[model samples]
Target: MKLLVFAHRLELGGTQINAIDLAAFLRDRRGVDVTVHATEGPALELLRARGLPFIPAPDVRLHPSPARIRALRDTVCRVRPDIIQAWDWWQGLEAYCGVHLPEGVPLVITDMMMHLTRAMPRGVPTTFGFEGLRRQAEAAGWSRTALLPPPVDTEANAPGASDGAALRRRLNVGGDAVLLVSVSRLSEYMKSESIKRTIEVVRELGDTLPLTYLIVGDGAAMPRIRETAGRANAALGREAISLAGAMTDPRPAYAAADIVLGMGGSSLRGLAFGKPVVVTGEAGFARLFSPETAEGFIETGMFGHGAGGADNAALSGPIRALARSPDLRTALGAFGREFVVANHGIEVVGDTLLRVCRAAVGYRPGRVALTADAARTAYFYLRERRFRVASRDAVERG
Candidate 1:
């Protein structure tokens, strides 16, 4: 089947990465003709390396841009794909608007976020990242929804996939130091607070144990994260918290790490690298992956939500234990690699997507329903833009 995969952006983010990986798998392994469409970023290199057919998407200055719609429409006319798979809800909406009513190609959405939005069309076949969110979509009366967990490329991310010695030497990490790495976007929404708390935990423990926290990635929260890292380093009287900025492929860092601390796709990649992962999430959620905790992560995705607030103590416990025992870390790391290869391997996820697409083909939404979905999404976009402006004005006024 010919497929057009719409990546939200070709950046070093989870959802887009998953989209690209799946596209490659489908084309090379499953023999599906696939093309990727996206606005280019650092991940452009990765895409080119994968050798997939590429279509440059129009740059976005705003949500639901007319130019973007026109661009997608033109591409759809040229490619005439059997199915258009969009990586997230916004891209899904864009694809929905771009396809002509008479074309009748199905638009399938894959949303990786923990929450759902009312703006997505109920008629489209949607796949969520976790089982809990899929059940929530069903409960909300969405017509068709499935669970497609974010996939990890086990071969590319496996232990010894890259040379860790070079990275360790460049970072000046000592042999005895416990190298803790977190590869994330550094976004403020769900990551900044947890990142800062992790930095604090590293600082508190640095006095007694050899510890180094390596943060990998850059975003809006960079300033805040840098500030926190500065304070932590000052308290430790050394550079215990290191920032490696960002990389298109973080395999070297992952390979070099003694323990990984992160959420979502980053956590999964850590496991793929045979590194023990301390899954960190919003509101002070941190847990070591083991047989007991495996089921919970599988059900809810590789993230956790806590009610109270950020607690540094909660994060420190697991890191401290891992730092103390080499045997425990080695055993857990082996378990983690086995678990990821069994459950979240890219080939497994690619087959599931193929099944979803085969089921979704030849299905089309009514004109009235399509129009309503667009209207609802437009209204939500406008409201969101206004709120952003108002918040910016308030900050400026202050």
Candidate 2:
């Protein structure tokens, strides 16, 4: 079957990266012909470099544009896909606004962020990030939804620091310095305040710790984030913090870290690299992904709720602890790597998505379904509350 995929832009966020991976597996393993379209971004650049069949659409937007919509519709009609899938919110909107499909040409959406269900039109089948989202979507009268985590190639991400020395040297980090790496889109909404606070902790730890904070990836917040890092390093009169920016391949950054920190897909990728990850998100939420905390992390969509909710004081413990103890890091890293492989590797989760797509192909949804309203936004508000409570419970019970 021919499959058409849409994404707004490709900036190496796990969501977009996973979309690329999903398209690849569908073409390679599932024997589906796939074409990916995007508004234009670094992901398209990466795709073109890799010789993938990715097309760039001009000026795609959320607020409605007639020309872009017509272009999208024309593209869809030309491809005449058996199934059309949107990997995120804007693309989901584009799928609806862009064209009305012929009967049986199912439209599939992947609501990876959990804040998108309400924005999706009724009867649209969505694949959610976790069971929490699936349950939430079902309660909203959505008849079709599936659960799947982003996939990681565990073998490709296997543990070892073969490139660590070269990367550290290239970044100007001292040979003896301890490295803390976060490979995430450096922005408030994407990372919460975790990345900013982590840098603060590095400054607070001062010259005593001999630590280097390496931030990888980029976003709208890149200028601000880079400025902060630049000022901190200038004030310190050393390369205590380095912004390597977005990499076409972040595996080198992953390989170079003594400890990895970030939330969502970044955290998962860190785990895949066998690096101990401290999970943090939109609040000042932070926590180590230990065996004790793993269940709650998995249950709540693998993101953390900071104790102080954007407080560096609250965020410093997990990073400091991991930095201080290699043994602790080793154990936690092992657990994370094993957990990712066993539960979320590409072969495992990719197959789940393939099955979901196959099932979506043969089914249709009810027209009398729920409205695409504020349901997801409301759920996000409530979910954060639940996550905050869970983080507190874990600490108290510990």
The top-ranked prediction according to lDDT is 1
lDDT comparing candidate 1 with the true structure: 0.83
TM-score of 1: 0.92
Off by over 4 Å in 2: 100-104, 160-162, 188-192, 234-237, 307-310, 366-398
- Candidate 2: Cα lDDT at 142: 73
Q: Which 10-residue window of candidate 1 scores lowest in summed lDDT?
A: 389-398
Candidate 2 vs. true structure, TM-score: 0.86
Residue-wise C-alpha lDDT for candidate 2, range 1-398, written one tens digit per residue: 88888765566667777887778877777788888877666777666654557766766333334555576677777788877787755566556556633234577878777454364554667888877767887898777778887788787677773477689888877766779998876654546257788888888785677788998877667788878788788877888888887887888889889888877777888998889988776557777788998888766776755455435765678777877888998999889999999888888888887787778778754443222333443354345442121110011000
Which RMSD values do the candidates have, in order? Answer: 4.2, 6.4
lDDT of 1 by residue, 203-234 (tens): 88999999999999988899999999999999
User: Weakest 10 consecutive residues, lDDT, candidate 2?
Assistant: 389-398
Error of 2 at 305 (Å): 3.4
